[model samples]
Target chain A: MSDAVVLGLDVGGSSVKYRLASATPSEGIPEALAQGTVSTPKHDPVAGLAAIARDVTALHRLVAVVVGIPGLVDEASGTVLRSANLPALDGLALGPALSAELEVPVGVINDGRAAAVAEARWGAGSRERDVFTLALGTGIAGSHIVDGRVVDGAHGIAGELGHVVVEPSGARCACGQRGCLETVIGAPALRRAWNRAGGHGSPKDLLSAYEAGDARAARIIERGAAALADAILTLLALVDPGVIVIGGGLASAPHRIVERAAALVAERATFHRVPAIVPAILGKWAGAVGAVSEARELAGCVVGASAG
Target chain B: MSDAVVLGLDVGGSSVKYRLASATPSEGIPEALAQGTVSTPKHDPVAGLAAIARDVTALHRLVAVVVGIPGLVDEASGTVLRSANLPALDGLALGPALSAELEVPVGVINDGRAAAVAEARWGAGSRERDVFTLALGTGIAGSHIVDGRVVDGAHGIAGELGHVVVEPSGARCACGQRGCLETVIGAPALRRAWNRAGGHGSPKDLLSAYEAGDARAARIIERGAAALADAILTLLALVDPGVIVIGGGLASAPHRIVERAAALVAERATFHRVPAIVPAILGKWAGAVGAVSEARELAGCVVGASAG
Candidate 1:
């Protein structure tokens, strides 16, 4: 069954990214035999599966498929309890429905958790026993890989690291919490805070202003950095992961946030052995690769292999 | 071996609280066959083990023993990596040393985690799949019981939840962090904050003062409560335990803290199904009971049983 491979799909609101790889890739996350994206087919799970099936025609022997979506996933029933992005996907028995259509077992996972597992196993973490990955963008997404397994809370998603209140008097979040980490450090929040502080500049210019010792810009950057540091500290208090992988939509400027966060952690940590704070290597492909890895786990019936 | 029993010891700085119980408890942590406390022997791990061995002589058909200490524990080596209270116990191979003296399988665990395990399985958590227990004392102790197992970090302890920064310009923590949860809400810190706010009263008086409409007292109570609510929120974001058990060093007035914390959680939560905020029923016996439970896990070889 050398030609046998599994399909991994990272289902997003706008597009569907797919990875077709061997059930047991020799190296960690080898280049997929087949990969790419297509516009997401919305409205119903069945229509979505048909669109994917039509595009996924020329793949090798497909043994199984695992799909990652942004939501609270009930893996047992193979349904998305909720998805802020793909509301249409919610409450659909996508696993059973997709499995029936694809003629292979299908698995569902949170996209954030999928990325976390990929980074923990093969991306930036180098196969550490535990890892915490954060996707810092318009909103923040978080998940922990504990003992090499992604952990979700009682409600199927241990999500919203950004919801932690940082400033009791700061901007209100859509989640209705005021002064959340998101309000203090989210990319848009950073830009807004800069504007509120009288800096009429672009997001990229704020990075330059901070580097060039602009006092107002410095304070604004510090607030976000401090919030990120506090989040890091909170994660350390709870899970104590061996490594923390940082990635997502926030480009260039976020490196300074990461650097400051590392410094704050070093300055504040007494009992903690600070783990390597590294950038995610998988980048945009994390969710799809993670889906493949999880699929391999399910299909590879060897001593440690799983079948998704 | 219905007659066989296990010795569970909670080794603290000043006392060793113990319980002798059957491996197969008929119910969730029945009253121990024998239970009590003795002054701790200091200066050496051997002497400590000897004292415990001597007191444990009257127990019946001992199959195993497990000890809980306030420190980072290397369970495999049966050693306390470090303990703030019993400094001499640090780095000592207590498990191997005790096993040699008692001729029984011995295990070592962090006292906080031990209590968490007990509370999750046989105490307030009511055997929930996920439980997060916080021992609110001079130092806040915390642990998560996920899928019925106590989780520690890479270095044997996922500790220092109190170290999470809550205030940037607030009091300095002994751990060298500013505005940690401990600085805002630890028993001693609460007393100091109350005193610093010009309240010339005892710890118990602060509770009544807040009840009597004292603004300063209210703020003091609110700060502690808000800090706790943030910690609770952080836990929800990470592990999403089904229940949260609160108990420990802060007594009497702390009920108000719990009440305020619950209110804040309810007000702030948009999607989180607020977990049951309950008091720990096992109280002082949690660590000892947890040790016994862990011992049972070690000796019992059923599907869900573990030898830890």
Candidate 2:
């Protein structure tokens, strides 16, 4: 077994989160030797990733690296197919370029998928074999973990749950679709709905108002919850995961989105086994943790292939 | 290698289809040695299955048997958890009873999942690794095939796509859910919509009228088609299969459900890889063919385990 430490980087819109850990296949994701956040370069993502990698490597003896990008990624060829937030990363050969620069094996994974891997390995989903993790923040995204591995379907776009149109001719979505789950249940959507209902301040305030018996806030939240429940039930019927780990900005709140959705699921689900819907325990660092898990698996595969 | 012939049975609501074939795991499901259908004993499903198994075994040297049940089935223990069509099968230990009588390895699989396995092995999805097959006849049931194996989920209800609520508060479903895909797109639902639109002898008549430019027929068909499109998009976003094979009574039509859903998917899918929507070629015998495939797999597993 390789005892070499590996680096995991999760590049976000505002910052880059990272962790350095020794990849041990048998033990799963271990405690990070060192972890921190860095300001991502606004204009250049590759340079930002490279800088973070260099800084991390300077402090740790890294043998491999995995970078989780918040976009559509072709994991096989290590290409960033499209990154809406990180425009510089669109069509970038992130894996090869980073590997060449860092002189180590580098892997690229979708950030949502990476979070799922992390959850499956060391977080809420650790005890489950099949799990679906949904991140419901600015946008809604998810990953399906089947038999301890995240399923990155034929076109590397498995678990794009947010894009599923819940309402055929409802609100316009950022993805150019009409009434996607994301359009109705994402953080932005919730905020807009709350504001449209004459509620003031942030989502936090809206949650407080809903909890405090504000009728308008209650109606808006219920609508979003119902839409989210519809999406969750759709997933439940399709994948039938043992559990669904809910993460992201909205889910992180106390008794918020996940709780609401869970209630709706119990009230609505029929015949199908209702999955245990729980909050993601890994929080903001889940992407980084999952990136480490992905790196470890990739390194193990490379070693096994070469040895064979 | 045991080259003994196996009998595959698909127990439907009105009829029981049977296929006798020699187990050939290497080349997938081979052409059946003999195949035919029999009227199902409406009073006793177990006796019906036993009669069919006895009839098949009398002619062929059957070493194994697989039965596809059209309801919730616990495949691991071969118990029919719930079969609305065959009430006598509910909570029965079909596998043990059938194995005891037949004196061979017996397997039971969900009919929808069996169709998915058959499609993955011998039909439109033969070349694909990840395939989602939807049987859109009396109901809108589906099965997800990942890496050529049907995913039955942890609770044996992974592909209950029919139960996924598309119109959350629309129509009541037989499964006690409101606005399920089945409530909107099932043959019965389409028939109801067609008849309400002031036309219809059969679903065929409705399809013909819609094709010939009848406004009321077009409206009814379009409503069902839109609901189906919503369900298909939901599946695509969540499972992201390489291809989606549409089968059952409604799918046999030319330029109907599958074509409409495909067009909707093409227009709606954003960032996610749109899967190929094709018609299932195996027709009515899909369940029986898939049952044979399941039996072959089970037999192979038994042989391998014993040998090891």
| Residue lDDT tens for model 1, B1-308 | 23677778998889999888876655656468888898888877666765675577464667778899998788888988889989888888999888888777888988878888888888888658878888887888877777668777776557456777777687888877778888988878888988999997665677889888999999988988888887777677666778888878564234788889899987877656689888888888889998988887766743222222
Please give the distance, in angstroms, between residue A54's alpha carbon in candidate 1 and its true position after superposition. Answer: 5.4
Q: List the residue pairs that clash in candidate 2.
A: none
The digit string of per-residue lDDT tens for model 1 on A28-126 reads: 564688889988878775667656754674545677788899887887778988888888887888888888887777888878788888888888886
Could you tell me which 10 consecutive residues in candidate 2 chain B have the lowest summed lDDT? B299-308
Q: Indicate the TM-score of model 2.
A: 0.90
* Candidate 1, position A241, lDDT: 78
What's model 1's lDDT at A60?
54
Once model 1 is optimally superposed onto the true structure by TM-score, how far is the C-alpha of residue A301 displaced, in angstroms?
8.5
Candidate 2: stretches off by over 4 Å: A39-61, A84-87, A167-169, A304-308, B12-16, B37-61, B85-88, B211-213, B304-308
Candidate 2 chain A, which ten residues in sequence have the lowest lDDT sum? Answer: A299-308
Q: Write the per-residue lDDT of candidate 2 for residues B115-183, one digit (tens) a residue.
A: 878888799999888888888888777878877787777676777778877786788999898888888
RMSD of 2: 3.4
In model 1, pairs of residues that clash are A297-A306, A297-A307, A298-A306, A298-A307, A298-A308, A299-A306, A299-A307, B137-B249, B297-B306, B298-B307
Which prediction has the highest lDDT against the true structure?
A: 2
Encode model 2's per-residue lDDT on A1-308: one tens digit a residue: 43467788999888999998776554655688889999877776666688888887675556778999988898878999998888888999999988887877899988888888888778998888888888877888788887668776777677888887777778998887788988887777878888998898878888999889999988877877777887877777777889988887777778465678789889977776888888899988989998987777776766442231
